[model samples]
Target chain A: MDTIIQCENITHYYGQKMIYEHLNFEVARGKILGLLGKNGTGKTTIINILTGYLKPRAGICRIFGEAMERLSPAAKSRIGLLLEGHVQHAYFNIEQIEKFYSRFFPQWKREAYYELLKKLQVTPVQKISTMSCGQRSQVALGLLFAQDPDLLILDDFSMGLDPGYRRLFVEYLKEYITAENKTVFLTSHIIQDMELLIDDCIILDFGRILLHEPTSYILERFRRFRFDSDAPAFPANDILRNTERIGTHWETYSFASAAEVERELVKNGATVSRLSEDKLSLEDAFIGLTGKY
Target chain B: MYTSLFYKEWIKARKLLLLLLVVFAAAVAYTLLTTIKQFHANPVAFWEFIVENNSIRTGYMRYLPLGAGILLAIVQLTPEMHNRRLKLTLHLPLDESKILCSMSGFGLALLSGLFILSGTALLLGLRIYFCPEIVYSDFIASLPWWMGGFTAYLLTVWICLEPVWKQRIFNAIPALCCISLFYTKALPGAYVPLLPWLTVLMTAGFFFPFYSAIRFKHGVQ
Candidate 1:
């Protein structure tokens, strides 16, 4: 695979608290990779480091085979970035902002930008600050598509958007990325959106990566099992994650097959009843892997 | 590309720029009227006041440039800092230092234009009513005050660009102290001795905002 972004043993800290240690990940070309974590899991920190806004405490991140902090203007032109709030030059009207950004990119597609804006209820003279969050999102996305970069790093692109707008954003982005064969690295608080968008995912636990696999891999193998048991305690190992018992109910999530989970439950010395295997959506799998606490 | 950058700054600052121009024109007009009224009321008394008190009729407008500088910096830079929107600018497909230099250059050019227009108006008005000696001296005395305007503008950029709040406070202290230098001397030619040094100071101060921009880009806090 051709790697577009490579982070090796990256470590960072905010004050004395270690956000992550020796974290490593890679984004291959033409893949949409999602970075998911709970609050304070350093999703934004990684984005900052990758974009050269924040220096890592240790290790290095390279994009297009150059150090991120020192990316040449030519290299920078190949990447599109959308900040967490979909921030743009708010003072500029729609046409003006497009004009402003078009000057920087050699291959800017004016029609690509205006095409997306055409879907919104915005005028050419409307300043971005006056637009709603949904409108601002379209503006930001429009600018990104116009840039037509080879790689796009979007930080929480779905933030502050209503569900309809979020779906619109994902659909537009999915179509664009598919048509252009672009590499994308993104994070979003809305995991359901990620289910429809990302090809690969890296689920971040506290200070470590819990899993990094293709979306299909996780969906195919990771399962949630539930049963009724009088046992007050349940045993957990590497295969079983976050085993919980409430009243006569027992539930756990694992990548093991149904027979393997049944054997493990039987060996745990609990009388299992009503054992059943359920497939998980991305959001449920995410919660199951990370736990509910 | 730099034109586009300039266009962006122009859009953000044009309203305040027009308002500052009007404020400057008003100051010059008010000074011209005051000088004409006082000289007509009592020529000999006005001469005595000019010679003994060393007070140019334009003294009331002394702080105008400084005020203009402060207001211009606020309007030009405050929005960029709002919600940390400077990231959008820095992320442009240009060298970070070049981007910052282009931005500060645009602001400095605008300040220069405002100062030159107002200064020339005051000089012409002074020449109409006073001797060449008084006009020249008055113009010379006003140079440092105008320098204060550019200094305040650049220093304000430095403060606003600083990413850390505590560092911004630290920057403000020295900035205020430096601007205070231009307001200390009262006489027409008093600042001539300090002009070269002030020029050097202003030239060096041009880079202070770039330094703050670097720190901000590095996520210093």
Candidate 2:
């Protein structure tokens, strides 16, 4: 796969507070990478830097092998972005908004935009201010997709969307990726919804990446072990980070493969029942890694 | 591409421009009616009518360009700045220079619309009242001077709102120089420096749109 976006040692500061330091990541073409982080964790800031809305205090960021600062007209023309907030002009209707965006992007597809509006059940003639948050989001999503950009950077696309709308949005993302072979970098707090769609994930906390790995690798290596109160204390090993005792049982997470951890637990004179690996959700992994609910 | 953006700006400001034109026409009509009424009351005192009402005429003429220019500048820049659409606009395929130039061109076009309205009033007023001896040529020549000054003032007002150059020299420097040069006879000719100052002001007004366009395009505060 080709690299679409590359950031190396990228540092950004907001006044005296540090947002991100020495952040490095690469996004491959035709892959949907999920940027997971708690609120106010520099996810939007990173998106801003990638889109050239904000300049980093230190280090370099490149999109399509060209420095972000040096993004030529041709390069910018190929990038589509849906900003975090409701960003369309309030006075413009969906149709006017589409027309305005089409002027800026050379490859904008009018037919695709109208088709997406129809698919999302949004009226093109409706004013943005009169539209609900979900409707506005749908329009923004439609506009972004219409650009037909090689890389689509969506900042919290599922924000303010209801469950049904979110599901519809996810469906659109899946369909677009499958049909067009497009690359997407989406940041959302709704981890479960993105679990199936994302090929890879980046877990962020305190402006640092806790983990960057494929979803399959994470599921294969990380295991959750639970034991009853009467069970014997498990033997200490390098794989386990910390163990906590709950009311009548012990729940622990181990970085080792499930089979390896299970074998070690059984050797400690404890009858360990392996929990189904399918039970591990992205939210579980996120909490296990960040220690945040 | 630049023309398309300019056309979009025009569309956005068109309604406001229409309201401005209506206001300008009403004010002009009111002034003409009152001036004609005063003239009918006393034929010999027409020159007094001209002098006493000179300030009013000048104020009315001044208001047209100044009002329209300031209105256009505010309506053009405020929404883009507030909505953060400026960031998206700046990232477009066009150069910052081209975008700004196109916006400024739109502003100038709006200013020209005001000039046309003012010219219509002047011509209609002169034709109806038969003021052949009133030296219309002098007024015509001096109209550009005031237009230049008004355009500069409008431009300065717009630039003050931008995040660049917090000092606001563009906003204050023009007025101060104009006042000092006119009052102190600082240059070779009394009005010579004023002409360039007006030119500079008009030029700056032309650049105000570009300043906003670049600021929007570059995401510079």
Candidate 3:
């Protein structure tokens, strides 16, 4: 598989606060990659860097195998960017906005855009500002689809959507990309919605990437072992790469077998109760890795 | 692509441009109506009055251009900056500077065109009452005001695109100083020494907003 998006040793700081440090990742062509993190973990910052809206203090981000900071307009044309909060020219009506963008892209697909937007029951002449957030997202999405870009980068696609709208968004995107040889990199706080959508995922925490791998690999191997005690010792090791401990409840992240986890926990002086094994959801793994802190 | 870029900006700017033109026309109409009355009452007195005491009308008319400049820039860029619509604009498949230039250039072109049209109207409308010399006096005196619109646009662009609020105040100082140079009251031909300087400053001021744009593009805030 060819690499479509690549970031190397990215270091960024918002004033004195470090957003990311020596962070590295990549997206394969035709792969659906999800950037998962809690608030202030620098997911949006990474997106901005990839789109060349921001320049990092150190390191380079490349899209279409070109340096993103200096990505030419030709390179940019291959990328479709959906700004956070589904932003667009609120001044233009649906038709006017579409007309405005039609001239920019050589592969502008007007029918494909209008067909998707028509489902929202919005008239072509309605101003984007006058529409609800969900409707505006549809407009943004329609424009992206119409642009026929090779890479679609959606920043917080589920920021303000109701579950129904989010489901529709995912279903439409899921159905669309399955047939096209396109790359997708999206960030979202709604992990459950993304669980069914992303093939590969990265979880970011405290300015560092905790995990970046296939979602199925993570789901299949990574297990959260919970230990309950009056005073449970915090499990820390190479085995437990990330841990979440709260009051009397403690959980440790490990890709090791159940017996290995039991041995580690027993040595750590935590009384294992039932030692139940449950398939971890993407959200669970994210929380286990990132923690409540 | 450039045509559509201009059209997009034209759509945002046309209403304000039209309104500014209308307001200017009304002012010119008033001046013409009063000029005709003065000419009818006493032609000699009317010519004497303009040549000797014309600073009053010129000062008032000059502000028209300045105000148009300020208003046009505010209407076109303020909301876009506040909502960060410039982000969407910069993401287009064109050189960032080129896009920024087109956005500001569209407003400049249309606003300049409107001011020129207003100047022409004043010249033709004043012709019914005044001689060629008198019409020239009025028209030439109002030139700075027309140019003031461009200055206002530039200043506002500087201030609007400056991402940081503290830095915007710093930018406004120089912009305001640049605009104040045009407001010095003088007769029809008195600006001969000042016009070239103002034009230079206006030409140079073209890059002020782009400074803010480059800073914004770099995430300088």
Candidate 4:
């Protein structure tokens, strides 16, 4: 794989609280990698580290073979960053903002930006601060597209978008990235959108990465198994990631085969008369790996 | 790149700049008109007061430059701190210090322009009624206060750029102390001997904002 972003032995903390320790990951070129985690699992922290906003306690983050802290101006031009809340120069109107950013990037695509802006149907004089959250998102996205960077690090792209705008953003971003083969590292609260956009995902639990795999791999193998249990207690084991019991019915999640799960349940002294396995979406797989807590 | 950065700053603070300009004009006009009216009413008494008291009639203008500096810094920098929007600026394909320099440079440059305009207008207006010695003394007397404007603007940038609230408040203490130095000797020609020191402080003030910018970049909060 042609690596675009690499982090080695990254350890970070806030005050005395460790956000993550010895965490490592790499993003390959031309791949969309979704960072899925709960609210405080350091997803944004990773974005900050990758973008050179935050320095990890003990690690080196390099993009395009250059340390993030020392990325050259030329190297920086190759990477586009979308901050949380879709922040841009809100004081500028759509036209003025475009004009302002165009000077920095030699290869700025004016049409690429305007095309996205057209979909928003905002007038040329519409200041970004006056626009709705969804409209602001489109403007931010438009700037990124115009920049046409080789790597895009987007933190929580679906932050405040309505369903229609979210879908529009996803579809537009997908078409653009696919057409240009751009590498993307993004996170979002909305997992369904992640399912539609990310080619691979890194599911982070507290202080550790639980799973890093392709979206298809998790969707294909990870599953939810529901079974009936007359016994009051269900034993904890590595095979079943998480288990919940309601009355006599027990629902569990695992990546194991149905037969192995059934055998394990029987050996665990549970009266499992029936066992059913249901395929999981990305969100389901995310919850299964990280648990529903 | 510098032009674009300046353009962005211009757009952000243009309205405030216009307002500040109006205020500067009004202040200069008011001071000159009041001086004219008082001098016309009692030319001999006013002349005696000017010569014996060694006081220029521009006391009301003492805080105008300082106010301009503060307002300009607030208008220019407050939005950049909002929602951590400075990250977008630092992320630009330029050296972080260079970017910050351009930003602070723009604000300082605007303040410089306004100060020059008002200062020159006051001098020319004073020239109409006073001798070279008196006008020169008054201009010299006002230098420290104008220097305060620059220092205040820089200090405010330092405060606004600091990512940590505690550190921001800490920064303001020394800033206030430094600003107090400019006001300590307000008499005509008192600051003449201190111009060298004030220049040194103003030079240091130019770079003070970078400390906060670095902290912000490191995610010090």
Candidate 3, which segments miss by more than 4 Å at Cα?
A228-232, A241-250, A268-273, B42-44, B53-58
Q: Write the per-residue lDDT of candidate 1 for residues A1-293, one digit (tens) a residue.
A: 89999999999888898988999999999999999999989999999999998888998999999998898989899999999989888999999999999999989999999999998988899999999999999999999999999999999998999999999999999999999999999999899999998999999988989899999999999999998877777777888888897556888999999888878887868777898999999999999999987
Q: Order the candidates by lDDT, highest first.
A: 4, 1, 3, 2
- In the range B131-185, model 4's lDDT, one tens digit per residue, is 8889988888888999999999998998889998899899989999998898885
Across B1-221, the per-residue lDDT of candidate 3 in tens digits comes to 98988877877787887788789889878867766676788878766867686532534466788888888888888767866788888888899889988888988887878777877887887776557876676666767777777988888988999888899999888888889888776556688678888898888878989889878877887
Give the range where candidate 3 chain A is weakest over 10 consecutive residues by summed lDDT. A227-236
DockQ of each: 0.76, 0.39, 0.74, 0.86
The CAPRI classification for model 3 reads as medium
lDDT of 2 by residue, B107-200 (tens): 6777676767666776577557755544354254345544653565456445644655653466456545542332332212234435666566
Candidate 1 wrong stretches, greater than 4 Å: B53-55
For model 2, how does the per-residue alpha-carbon lDDT over A1-293 read when each residue is reduced to its tens digit?
Answer: 79999999988777777878999999999888999988777998888778776678898789999888668888888888777664767667887877777877766788877877786555667778788777777787787788888888888878788998888788887888778988888898889887868889998888688789988777777767665535657655566534556686666677776676666666757776543233467878777777644
Better model by lDDT: candidate 2 vs candidate 4: 4
Residues A168-273 of candidate 3: C-alpha lDDT, one tens digit per residue: 8888888777777689999988999889889999988888998899999999998887766544355467786565555666667788887988787777565666
Between candidates 1 and 2, the one scoring higher on lDDT is: 1
DockQ comparison, 2 vs 3, better candidate: 3
Candidate 1 overall Cα lDDT vs. reference? Answer: 0.90
The model with the greater DockQ, 1 or 3, is: 1
State which candidate has the highest lDDT. 4
